[model samples]
Target: MLKVNTENSVRYKGKPKKTSVNAGRLKLIERNKEKPDVARIEKPTTILRGMRLIDPNEVNKNMICSNCRKQLAFNHIVEEKTTGFHHIWTMKCDTCFTLTKCHSSKSHFNDGHLYYDANTAAVLGAVHSGAGCNALRKIAMRIDMPVLSQETYKRYEREIGSLIEEAAKDSCQGAAAEEQNLVVEHIDTLRDKL
Candidate 1:
């Protein structure tokens, strides 16, 4: 900044004359301060958990929910606890409580969604709820026909199939809801144009 004296001279030096500045102006000047920390993003809340599986190395790349058939992640397959000789790896989906498996067998079936009838599933020693379904499927799936009963067959015939479908649709709902909100807001803003 340049200073002028009463004699109309630009050189108004007085032992480095210091001018006072307003507090607000001082604040406006940028300061050399430490940078802020970056925020960490969180994982989705709906991710499923508690699934049981067998072989991680042999997990199917395309294996997904058997009911909804939504493609599942390899890491999401939870291991089921069982009394067996072969080593197994398992996981449970966080979004839905669907239990999946990857059993170590001779047939070479990789990581696949182990689905079971909700009704006969119980007879096979697997209950529908996380109460212990994955653990049951690991043992029962190997037994052909799994001793299906008349009542069990009639009851869970449709439920197990629907579980997968519902899960798939649910996985897409959160994004759809956000999109729908944007659309609604846009329509409201453009109401005068219509």
Candidate 2:
């Protein structure tokens, strides 16, 4: 599970305000291998690290360049997250200025990977310069996709790629079938942000 914001540099926001279930419920779910009713903090969980987590296995076809207002290059996927110190967050485009809010599951991958705040990164910096400084930079140096560990990366693609393409195809068909013009306020507002 993941969440992101398009407006401000706030890391993953929109985590639920609080969980309806208590810790006991969580433990029960864990024991049953069922999903937990994860809740967000009073505010959104601060993103301590940035992840490019991408669907590198499948080609991306529903690419939209916020700056261009045109379809982006096929197979183009960009993911930027907050990392390093001071909540360093990034997106694919440098021109994004709009804001958005969304809520998602809190499932971090099973991997030990986790987001870290500047303080956390600093502590880590003492151990690894390149490791603590900039995850975006680090990931780029390692592979073409931001989330590059061949096996994990493929899983990432499998999870997100199909969802994106299916959405695009459904949107297109829906637009053709309906004469009503849906006011996509966010898209219009975020169009200039690339």
lDDT of 1 by residue, 117-151 (tens): 22334533333454344444454555522333444
Alpha-carbon local distance difference test for all models: 0.46, 0.39
TM-score of 1: 0.21
Candidate 2's C-alpha lDDT? 0.39
TM-score of each: 0.21, 0.22
Q: Evaluate candidate 1 by giving its C-alpha RMSD to the native, one decimal.
A: 28.2
lDDT of 2 by residue, 28-50 (tens): 86876664345632334443233
Residue 194, candidate 2: C-alpha displacement in angstroms: 41
Candidate 2 lDDT score at position 184: 57
Model 1 steric clash total:
31
